[model samples]
Target: MKYFAVFLPMLNEEKSKQYRGDHIAYLEEMDKKGKVYAKGRFTDGAGGLVIYIAETFPEVEELVKQDPYVKIGAREYEIHEWDMKVTEN
Candidate 1:
């Protein structure tokens, strides 16, 4: 599987907060399925990011398309393949 980084740029904060519960549920489900590795909002409040493990870009794209934020048009997103990881042991 390849790793993907999803960047969500919030379009409407009020709307986003309203749907945040649903969005969290979606992410939790993905996490249970092992499709999500990590997720969080940026410190500046611009938006959030989700790290995904999927076979292809289309696979990740489809996942994002189902997000509550996306469904409500509360955010726009960009997805990029993450091909490398570094860790200090």
Candidate 2:
């Protein structure tokens, strides 16, 4: 399985706060299920980014579609399929 990074460019601060808990819960579930390798929010606090390892693009897309932000239409995402060229550990 290859890794892909999904970038979410969010807009409404109020809406994001409203859905924050649910979003975190969802990410936790995904991580537990081994769908998400790692995830985090931007330092500037504008949006978020998540890295997922999956079998195919469709699977990645399906997982991303489950995000609360996407469901509520509070944010939009750009998905980039990545090839891991190097790792220290």
Candidate 3:
């Protein structure tokens, strides 16, 4: 699986709040499907981040489009491909 870091910077906090529950539900659903690796929000209310695992970046992009945040235009996302390094020295 490939990893992607989704950087979400809040665009409309009010709108985000309105759809927060749906957003969490979406993530939880993805987690059940083994799509989400990790997720969290910024304490400062900037936005949130989600680490996703998928076969390809386009696949991840498709998943992101389903997020409430994206669907409602509450935030903007920047997707970065991540390469995890393991140390077994």
Candidate 4:
């Protein structure tokens, strides 16, 4: 599996807030299906991050498009191909 980092920058807080429930549901569903590795929002509410493990970048992009935030244009995403080496818990 290859790692991907999705940077979610909130473009419209109101829109994001309006769709928060659906966004969270989508994240939870993906987590349950093992598509999401980890996710969280910034403390200041600026945006969030979602790490994913997929076979290719296109898979990650496709999965991201299904997010409510992206679907509604409440937020914009910058996806990066990531490489990580874990050394500590």
* Model 3 / residue 36 / CA error / Å: 0.5
TM-score of each: 0.96, 0.91, 0.94, 0.95
Choose 1 or 4, whichever is better by TM-score.
1
- lDDT of model 2 at residue 62? 92
Better of 3 and 4 by lDDT: 3
Judging by TM-score, tell me the better candidate of 2 and 3.
3
What TM-score would you give candidate 2 relative to the actual structure?
A: 0.91
- For candidate 4, the lDDT comes to 0.94
lDDT of each: 0.96, 0.89, 0.95, 0.94
Residues 32-81, candidate 1: write the lDDT tens digits: 99999899999999999999999999999999999999989999989999
Task: Please give, for residues 1-89, the per-residue lDDT of candidate 4 as tens digits.
Answer: 98899999999999999999999999999999888889999999989999988999999999999999999999999999889879996
Error of 3 at 79 (Å): 0.2
